[model samples]
Structure formats: structure tokens, C-alpha cells
Target: MPSFHHGAVEIAYLDEGEGEPIILIHGFASSKNVNWVYPGWMAELTKNGRRAIALDLRGHGDSGKLYDPAEYGIGTMAGDITALMDHLNIRRADMMGYSLGARITGWLAYRQPERLRSAIFGGLGIGLIKGGGPGENVATALDAPSLDDVTDPVGRTFRAFADQTRSDRKPLAACLRGSRELMTEQQAAAIRVPALIAVGSKDEIAGSADQLGKVIPGSQVLHIPNRDHMRAVGDKVYKTGVLEFLLRRP
Candidate 1:
């Protein structure tokens, strides 16, 4: 429940465990608990003797919410992560993110590679290079009054997830509008840190993990069987692969 100022917004975060730090970034409509804690990610990482930290992005969880779309740009979210890093006096740490968080990780890997010992991206892949985004359907879904009023399948699912999570709708909608930019192939190719992309074999939201690894050169890929985006975050296979990667690399 501890919080700090990052620019004009107050970012809330949880810092737990001990040893080498690893920041955990949750996906869209997910708080740190829903994304990492409830999934036993913190326990697993900490049990392995690594410090675990997670924060609510500006529009998500307990972070200060901004209704304006401009406040949730991809670059802005990346800055929030670095600002948290600065606040903690930690220069570099291994970091991991899922879905929207993975996209933010992509930005960080490009924008502040110096601040990362390694990067783990879950539920995202080469789609960043293909130029697609959540678009107006997702925004409209977030704006809809109820699930019955939503028609688009993807949007309906996200809207329902938001409702289930009790997320602030206005800010989440604005986030969908502002942070939809995916990474370009050139940017993905430019990542200089050790990285891993773990994804569900059935996850349609993230693009091809194989294509992403091929482009990143030396980046490892873990494709969890019989899982989708919603299920992939909590999957044991994904966690095992990531832990092994971090342990081996560290």
C-alpha cells in the first residue's frame, strides 16, 4: 500500500522479498495482486532469493488515475517504472511484465536498457512489430455501461475483466486510447539486454513468439501449452521457464 510521487501522479507499489530485485508489471485491467501476487509469482521469486516489486500503472490499481488519454502514453508508463526505480535507489534489476505490461517492458528495453539486468515479457511477442493495437473497440468497451451493452468479443472480455477487477473505467479507457502503440521491428531488434519472451501457445493477443525470438537474437521463448492470455499469466510452465531463465542468467 506504500506510494510515491512520479511526476504529477502518485504511484502505489508493493516491495517484497530479498536479494537481486525484479520488478513485476501487470497487464491491462490487472492490479499487482491479480497479475503477480495471487499467482504466487512473488512467493516463487522470493523463494528463489530474489526481491520482488510490483506497481500499479497510472491508470490501474491504486495508482493515481488520469482521465485524459495523453497521460497514459507508452513512453509515460515506461517513465513511471524508471521513476519507481529512482525512488527506490535501485539502478538495475531484472524485470518482467505481462500483456500491456509486456508492451511497457518493450518500451523500457528500448528506452532504458541501462536500468535492466534482463527483461521477461509474458503474453506478448512479434505483434509489436506487425503494427496492431486495441483500437476504438477496446475504448468503447471500457466506456460501455455494462457487459450486455458491449458487442465486440475482445472488448467485451476486457470490459468484463475490468468490471471484475473494479478498475476505474475512465482512466482505463484513456489508457487504451493512449498506450496502444506496439513496438516496431527495428525497436525490437535494438534491445541489447538479455531477454526472454514467455507466452501461451493458444494466446491470440500476442503475436508469434518464435518470430519475436528470431528477431531479438539470443532471446529465449517459452510457449505454454493449452493456455491463453488470461490463463498464461498464472501458468506453472511460464513461471518455471522464467525462474530458470533468471537463475541461469543471474
Candidate 2:
């Protein structure tokens, strides 16, 4: 339940164990507990003698929520994390993120590669392209009714997301609308640290395992069979794969 002020926002985080720190960044809409703790990742990391810290990103969980769309941009979000690290006096640490969190980690790696020991990205790929135009308003995108209005397969996925949003509407909607920008190839190639890219075998957004593996250089890709986006992180294969990758490094 401890919290830190990162500029105007308050980021809620959990710090456990007492060794080289590993920051776990949760996905859009989901809190730290849902992404890492509920999956037993914190216990697993602590049991292995590594310090694990999971943060509730701004506008999610116990963190402050800003209704302004500009406040939710990836750059702004990444800055929040760097500020959190500064507040803690941490020079560097291993970092892991999923979905929107993964995008933020990518921005951090690009901006301050020296501060990271290693990185793990889940449920993301190297398609760093801009979605909406620069002047387009994020609120407009979010205000549009559920994607069920469209006929494409991707639209169906968005509709499913919208269904999830109804249960916990604010945070997930903010995340979905906020993550309009994509990661550039230049940024992906710049990540020289030991990287791990993992995705569920059935993750529609990231595509097949081999396709994702080819984009990230020096990345070890693990496929969580019979699992899709929602179930991947909790799957035994995903957990074991991530731990093995993290422990393999110095």
C-alpha cells in the first residue's frame, strides 16, 4: 500500500525481498496485483532471492487518475517510472512490463539504456507505428462506442476489450485510448541489454511466436501454448519461462 509521488501523480507500489531490484510494470487497466502478484510472480521472485517491485501505474489501481488524455501518454508514463526510481535512489534495475507497460519500458530503454540491467517484454511486438494522427484527440477515440460497431476481426477484439472495460471501466478505457502510438524499429534495435520477449501462442495482437521472436534482437521467445492474451501471464509455462530467462543472466 506504500505510495510515492512522481511529479503530480502518485504511484502505488509494493517492494519485496532484498537483493538486486526487479521492477514489474503492469499492463493497461490491470494493477500490479493482477499482473504479477495474483499470478504468484512476487512469491516466485522473492523465493529465488531477487527483490521484486510492482507499481500501480498512474490512473490504475491506487495511483492518481488524470482525466486529461495528454497525461496518459507513454512518454509521460515512462517519466513517472524514472521519477519513481529517482525517489528511491535506485541507479539501475531489471525491468519487466506487459502490454502498455511494455511500451513504457521500451521508451525508458531508448531514453536511458544505461540504467537498465535487463528487460523482459510480454504480450507486445515491434510494430512501432503511429495509429491516429498527431492532432487527433485521444478522448475522441475513447468516446466512440464499442468496437462491436465494426466488422473486422480486430474490431471484435476491441469489442471484447470493451466488455472487460464495463467491469472496471475507467483505467482500461484510459489505457486503450492512451496507447495509440507504436514503437519504432530504431528503438527496438537500440535495446542492447539481454531481452526476453514472450507471448501466448494464441495472442492475436502480437501474432505467432516465431513472428514475434524475429523482431527483437538477442531475445529469447517463449510460447505459452493453449493460452491467449488474458491467460498467458498466469500460465505455468509463461512463469517458468520468464524466471529462467531472468536467472540465466548475471
The best candidate in terms of lDDT? 1
How displaced is residue 250 in candidate 2, in Å? 3.8
> RMSD for each model, in Å, please?
1.0, 3.8
lDDT of 2 by residue, 150-186 (tens): 4455444544554554433455456556666677666
> What C-alpha lDDT values do all the predictions have?
0.89, 0.72
Which portions of model 2 show Cα errors greater than 4 Å?
127-168
Question: Which prediction has the highest TM-score against the true structure?
Answer: 1
Please give the lDDT score for candidate 1: 0.89
Candidate 1: residue 148 Cα off by (Å)? 0.4
Per-candidate total of colliding backbone pairs: 0, 2
TM-score of each: 0.97, 0.84
Model 1, poorest ten-residue lDDT window?
Answer: 126-135
